[model samples]
Target: MRQTRRAIALFLLVCSILVPLPVGARQAAANPFAELGLPELAVTITDTAIEGAPAERTAGRYVLAVTNDSTAGAPPVVSAGVGFLQPPEGMTAADLIAFFATMATGPDGGASPVASPGAAAEMEGPPPWYYEVPLAGGIYALPGETAYTVLDLAAGEWVLWAEDPTAPRPPVAITVTGEAPANQPVPEADVTITMTEMAFALDQPLAAGPQIIALTNEGQQPHFLVLATVPDGTTVDDVLQLSMTFMDPSATPPPNLSFEQMQDIANTADLSAGITNWFSVDLESGSYLLVCFVPDQETGIPHAMLGMIDVVTVP
Candidate 1:
C-alpha cells in the first residue's frame, strides 16, 4: 500500500503541473454579494490565544482577515476554522470527551487518533462539520505575514481553535446565528477557479493586484485552494521532484536543487463538496502554483496527486 501510494502521489504531482482542470458552466457576471454586502470579521492570531475573536457570527458568507502577532521570528503555523459537531442524541460534553479520549488512545493502546483525513467514521460519532482555512504550505505565517480566507457558515454552534493544541487559548465557543443577515455587495471576482474531482478550470488568465478568487468545488469530497508563488528560474518540474522527495523519503533526492518553499498569497479553508467560497488575495506579476492537498478517500492520496494542480501566470 505504501509503494502504491507513493507512486500515485508522484504521478499526481506530475499531472498537476502539466494538466489544467476542465472548465464548466461559467457563473453569471454579476457578483451576488456586490449589492448585498456580507460581513467582514476580524480574527487576530496570537502565540497564546486567538484574540479579538467573537463567540458568535451571522451565518452566511463572510470574510475573515487574520493578522499574526507572534513574537518576531517565524511563528508556528496555525490553522483557523470553525468545527461543528452534531453530537449523538443526548450526549454531553463529558461523554464526547470520554469518547474522544478513547480515540486518542485506541483499543490496542496505540497513539493514533481515531479520525484522520478521509476517515471520518473513525470519529466517535458523526463527523464534525468542519469549515477550516488550511494553513498555507502547512504554516500559518512567516515572521510577519498575514492573509485572509472567505468561509460560508451555516446556522449552528461551532468550536473555534487554532490548529495547535498546545497553544494557551482555550477552545472558543461560537454560535453561528441561524439567521443569515441581509445580503450585502461583494466585490466582483478578478479570477474564478472551478474545482472538480482532481481537476480545476479557469476561464481566463489572472492579472496582478488584489483579486478575488471565486472557488467553486463540484466534487463529492472537500477541497481547498493554495496560491504559492513560484520563484524565478524554478520550473514546475523542479517543484514536483522536490515534492516527491517528501512524499517518499526513500526516493533519491534531486541534486543541486534545494527545496525552498515559496510564499503563499492566498488560501481557503476546506470547502465541503458542492460548495462555493470566495477569498481575496494580493498578487504580483509572477508564476504561481494553484494546488489542493486534500487526500482522496479511497486511495489515501492527495487530490494534487490526482491532478489537482495547475500553473497560473499573473501578468
Candidate 2:
C-alpha cells in the first residue's frame, strides 16, 4: 500500500509541472508586436555623430529604437530628442544644416532674432522653403537608455537630426520607397491624447502605472506633447507663466514656481497635422502638466501661451 501511494503522488507532481499557465498570464508576457512582425530601425546618437540607420527602407510603419551614448561634458545629454523632416524638392541636407545655423545665429552672425519675443512676432515667418517641408514625429531617449516610437512614414526622402538648436548634429538622410504594409497592427493604448488647435483632449482619466499612449495631431499646425511633474500647489496657469519667461528673455519669472521644481517625464518630437504616433510612459501617482511649446504657423508665440496647457492627476 505504501509503494502504491508513493507512485500516485509522484504522478500528480509531474502533472502539475506540465500544466500551462492561464491565458491572461501568457498574454501579459507576450511581445506586443510579435504577431505583426514589424521591422525595427536602430538609431544611435553620440556626441559627434548619428549612426546605425539604414540608407533605404520600405515606406511604412517602423519602430524606431533610439539610444543616446554621450559622455563628453558636464551635464551631459540626459535626453536627446530626435526629429524627422521631409525636405522640399531641390533641397539637400547641406541646405537644411545652413538653415539651422542661420536660425541659431542671425544671418550676419549676430544674436538670433528669435531670442527676443517681440522681434519673433514682428519678423516674417520662416523662409518660403520651410512651408514646403513636412515634419514627421520622432522619439526621445535618455543617455544609455533605449526608447521606442512607432512612425508611419510615406514614400519620400527623410532627414533625421537632433531637435535641439543648441546642440545641432550633422543630419542623416534616408530614402523610403514602396507603400506601407496593409492591415498593420494598431497598438492597444491605455489612453489617447488628441491635439487640436491650442488644446489637448484626453479620452480617459490616467492611472499611475505603465501606459501605452496614442498621440494624434488633428490640429491644423504642428504640435508636440511634453509631460512634466510640478511641485504641489502648482497650477496650469503657473506653468504657463513660467514658460513665458523661458520663451522671452525679457519677461520676469513667476514668483511662485522655479525651474528646479519641475521634472520632465516624457516628450515627443513635432508631429504635423494628420500624424499619429505611439509611445510608452510610466508615471507614479502625482500631478502632471501637459503642454505644447511649438510655435504657431502665423505668430511665433508658443501654443502653451495660447492656452494649450492642462493639468492631470494620476491616482
Candidate 3:
C-alpha cells in the first residue's frame, strides 16, 4: 500500500517531532518562565521524560522529566515556587503580582550549597523581589535526580509554582510568559522595560514573539544581564569588545567561538539588593544592547561601564 502509506506518513511526522506538551496546550504566557526555557528562580528535572503535559516556552535545558509516580511508593511532595503570571484579558492582579516579584520562590527543596551571603533567602530575596546576581545554586533538587541548577530572570508576568508544600488545594501554577520579539510582548500599549542601576530603560517596541527581558535589581551590587545578537550595525564598542572576548583555545581560532564572539545569554538575572532578573529573546530588529559585566572589586567598575547599557527596539 505504497509502503504502508509511506510508513504511516513517517510515523505521523515522528510523532510531530518528538512531542511534549499537552497540559492545556501551553501558551498562556507573559512570563511562564519564558515559555519554560527557564529563568525566574528554577525548576529543572530530567530522567527520561514521561510525566504528562505542561512545558512549552521553547523547552531548552529547563529539564522536567519527573515521573516518580509515587503513590504507593510514596514521595508525592514535589514543590517549586515563584508566583503570578496568568493575566492578560484585561490585566491587573497587582500587575500580575508585580510580575511574580521577579521570581519569588519558596520551597527551595534542594540546591543550597553554601554561599548564603546574607540570606533574605540568600542574597536579596527573589521572593518579594531583590537581587544583584545571587541566584547561583537556586533551590536545587537532585536526590533521585531531575535537574536544573541555576536560573536567571526578570522579564515579567512571572509564575513558577509547583506544589506539594503539604498539598491541600492549589500549587501547580507555572505561568511564566516571558520572551518577546515576534509580536513584541503585546501589552497593547503599556509595554514597559526598566532594570535600574546596572542598566536598561529602553522605552518600547518589541512584539514579534519571544522577547521577555525584565530585570529589577533595586541596586546595591551583584547584577547580571547578558543577552546577545550580532551582525546588524554591531557597536557599543563592538558590544563591549564582544563582552570580554572569550574563546581562545590556544589562539588562531582553533575550535570555533572566535570572531571575538560572546553568547551565553542572560537577558535578566543575578540580582541582589531587591532582586529580580529575566532575559528572553526571539528578536530580529537589530542593534540591541543590555550589558552589565558585574564587576565591583571595591570599584573596578563594570556595570556595563557603569551605565548598564540599553538600546533595544526589536520589531
Name the candidate, 1 or 2, with the larger TM-score value.
2
lDDT of 3 at 248: 16
lDDT for each residue of candidate 1 in 1-315, tens digit (9 for 90 to 100): 223223322432332322222222222122223343556666666666666768677776665555656554222132233222322445543454344444334348554331222232221211322223211111133224445445566676554544222233444555677666566445477778888888888867888876777787777776767667765556655666666665555556456344343554555555666666666666789888777776676665667767887776777
Clashes in model 2: which pairs?
A: none
The candidate scoring highest on lDDT is: 2
Error of 2 at 40 (Å): 0.9
Candidate 2: segments with Cα more than 4 A from true spot:
1-36, 72-78, 92-125, 128-132, 248-252
* Candidates arranged by lDDT, highest first: 2, 1, 3
TM-score against native, each model: 0.67, 0.79, 0.23
Cα error, residue 94 of model 1, in Å, equals: 8.6
Task: Kindly list the per-residue Cα lDDT of model 2 for residues 1-315, writing each as its tens digit.
Answer: 222222222222211111111111111112234455678887888886778978898888887777766542332123565778887678775566665555545447764322223333333333444434677788766555667777787898888877643343567788889998889878888999999998999999878888888999999887888777766677887776665553455877678776656655667777888888888887898888888765566765567778788888887
Better of 1 and 3 by lDDT: 1
Query: Where does the lowest 10-residue lDDT sum fall in candidate 2?
Result: 19-28
Q: Could you tell me the TM-score of candidate 1?
A: 0.67
| Model 1 regions more than 4 Å off | 1-37, 72-143, 163-171, 232-236, 255-257
Best by TM-score: 2
The clash count of every prediction, one per candidate, is: 15, 0, 55
